[model samples]
Target: MKKRFGLLLALIAALVMLVVPVGNTTHAQAADNSLEKIQKKGVLVMGTSPDYPPYEFQATVNGKSTVVGMDVQIGKKVAKDLGVKLKIKSMSFDSLLVALQTGKIDMIISGMNPTPARRKNVAFTHTYYQGGYDIVINKTDKAKYKNKDSFSGGTLGAQTGTTQYNASKSQTKNTTVKGMTSQSDLILALQSHKLDGVAMEKPSAEAYVSNNKQLAAIPSDFNMSSSATSSAIAFRKGSTSLVNKVNKTVDQIKKENLVKKDYLPAAGKYLKTNTVNTSMTHYWKAFLTGIEYTLIITVCSVFFGFIIGILLALARMAKGNFFKNLLRWIATAYVEFIRGTPMMVQVMFVYFGLGLFVNLPALTSGIIAISLNSGAYVAEYIRGGINSVNIGQTEAARSLGMSNGETMRYVVLPQALKNIWPSLGNEFITLIKDSSIVSIIGVTELIYQSNIVRSDTYRGVAPIVVIMVLYFILTFTASRILNYFERKMQHD
Candidate 1:
């Protein structure tokens, strides 16, 4: 027995040695063809967060909402130099890096800073623009607070993952630094007196103060290194060829001072048009597009989620042989893992992790992620519903010379679905709201579109109110439709 055990261990070790690569894994590294790939595709995709004005923000051109700012101008120049068309992909600021690393976008030109921590993960071109920080405050409190130090004992806000946010946290004494995902949200917090001031780039602060009379700007006065204050374009690491090509554009822009001469002025013109009509009515088309995408995501997720739930429910209930038990274990584990993680993390994982191999479109990735999440929850409801069915009915079907599959199909599932109709309807309604989670990946759902409207109009609250009402109407209408079906199910 000892010799047999020794032999078994040796066999396992030998198998492991054969399966794993030993050394010198350079052959595994991907080739540096980033620039060639972009040119072949004929489109240089630039990722950005469009909420930051003067750097990247939403604007309406030719009656259509569009992304425009200094970063976009730089992206266009880089693409032109490469002899390719430019495409802008907008996501949250924090998601930009993940999106680039996952090959969802070719480059990032969203006024991104080349901090040391970021440089370790991605390659950066030469600095395209040198920028500084400013603190936005309520006009009434402008005199009360002179700089970062004056915010002592009060909360100062900044966009999460930004240099200003880090500076606010490190440089201030006896101050609470609050971070939010959106600059518009931070500004809203300031107006509502939730924050003493909001820290942001100087250009963005100027744009906000010029647009809103209630706001004023002051110097941040936080010590920073040049890398913390300089903006550059980011690419996936090891893209030396792409980085070198884009650096030429960056160098020419700096030599000619094109940012100050042309780009900033062009971005300023867009900011001017943004405030001309702050009313939600003028952006009706934007809201309509939002509703359309929202419905598309919710409907697709529900349909796929329900199908997946049914399969998982049946799999979890399986009991017979070794293979059947394995299926049950897998189904159970999947449901638990999905329920344990946040939907946002799951969405990002699906978009970035699964994205390593397949180049899924943002909308497609959103639906797939949301559907997988909803399925895990829906499985529980289905399992409970299936268990709630009387055992005697299943026994009766079995005794009628029917197989287990047939019994489940003819007797158990129909009754189970009927019993869980209301729960299923509730899940459907919940998904309508939860579908907004995909907005982080730039799906252009209602929340994303509303963010654009807020950035474009610079009236943060109005866009929120519009989306709130629109969501209520969507969920309310869905609830009524579900009720009608539930009534029909009961009557039958």
Candidate 2:
């Protein structure tokens, strides 16, 4: 027991040593050449959550859907000043900071606040937009609720991981605070009367109320410091050179009052156009793009995941030597670790954690993460299938002068796969649905496109129902194909 414990401690210490240096190296690199690198690349990538209207949201320009709003305008200005072309990457609001820190983006301008807590992890520029908070309630309850204080016994909703969310939980009395990932979801809840109010930035609240006549906004009345209400661009930690350069543009915007006179009015026009056609059919292109990406991710992940599963399943079943035992132990540990954690965290880790070493596009990262996750589960199924094979089959192959590898390759594996075909088919179908988790990192899959539709049209349920039917169509078609293959195999 003592020897085993010591060995475990040594393994843990080795992992820690491996992890610590990567962080230090990333920080050291970020401390310098931040501006030179962007100029050399000739493109400044700005990451933002495009679900927040008038701050940053999707809009149609020249009949092409794209990310727009005041924050995007600010990003364009910063990129122009740096003499680099601007590339906007739309993701969830909660992922912007991680994407910046991991170098997935050069900077973040997603209506994000520069609170002291966030400052510890990433560098922030001077404030570009100073905004306040508001609580949006159903217009019918506009008279009953005056402010945040009015929701004493009712539930309030806010986007998870925002300043307003934290404040709603900490500052309110006897009020139940509900957190959702998107502002559209919160507003949908309010419209359904599930929530008494939804707290958000003043501009967003106003936009929602104006677009949806059933909603009205009131002051949140929560005490806040300037840092909590102010928006700034964030870069990787120690990117002082880049932050200082971008501060010049932020200062110019504030001095010229461009946010009020220019950006807001421009974004409002898009909002008007967006509301003009809220019908689902108007956004078929968006959903089609979504289906294309979703299919790509699922198919790629399934093919690679099957290959990985075979290797891992073989490694887990290895025996007869010290090296084989070690391989088996490592494979078992990997399978357990993956199965224990959530797929969402794995997606983020692959995109952001591996990003420190090499830059990967969001689609590539999603495929890699989902493939790895699916491989672990598939390995277990393969292992069970192997176990179900009769020992006499292996003996029969060996007696016929077959080597161990030949036995597995020509005899055992083929039969084992036939036995496990149904399970593998189920895994493939499950992956079709599970692929939606990748949208958190902005892969532009079905769920992500649906979110853009929700934000664009301001009609939540229609987009959701459309995606629901689309997903069912995908899964149902996949199931029929799998069944046809199964029948063919059984006949053979």
Local accuracy of candidate 2 as per-residue lDDT tens digits, 1-20: 00001222233334433544
What C-alpha lDDT, on a 0 to 100 scale, does residue 45 get in candidate 1?
Answer: 90
True-vs-predicted CA distance for residue 482, candidate 2, Å: 1.0
- For each candidate in the order shown, give its overall lDDT on alpha carbons: 0.86, 0.87
- lDDT by residue (1-492, candidate 1, tens digit) is 000012222333343335335342233245567778878999989998898989999999999999999989999999999999999999887777767766789999887888877887689999988888889999999789899999999999988777788788889989999888898888888998999999998999999999999999999898988888889889987888989999999999999999999999999999999989888999999889999999999999999999999999989989999999999999999999999978887787777767766778889989999999989988999899889999999989988999988988889888898989889989888988998899988998899989999899888788999999999999999999989988898899
Q: What's model 2's lDDT at 147? A: 86
Q: What TM-score against the true fold does each predicted structure earn?
A: 0.93, 0.94
Off by over 4 Å in 1: 1-31
List clashing residue pairs in candidate 2: none
Estimate the overall C-alpha local distance difference test score of candidate 2.
Answer: 0.87
Error of 2 at 213 (Å): 1.2
lDDT of 2 at 370: 97
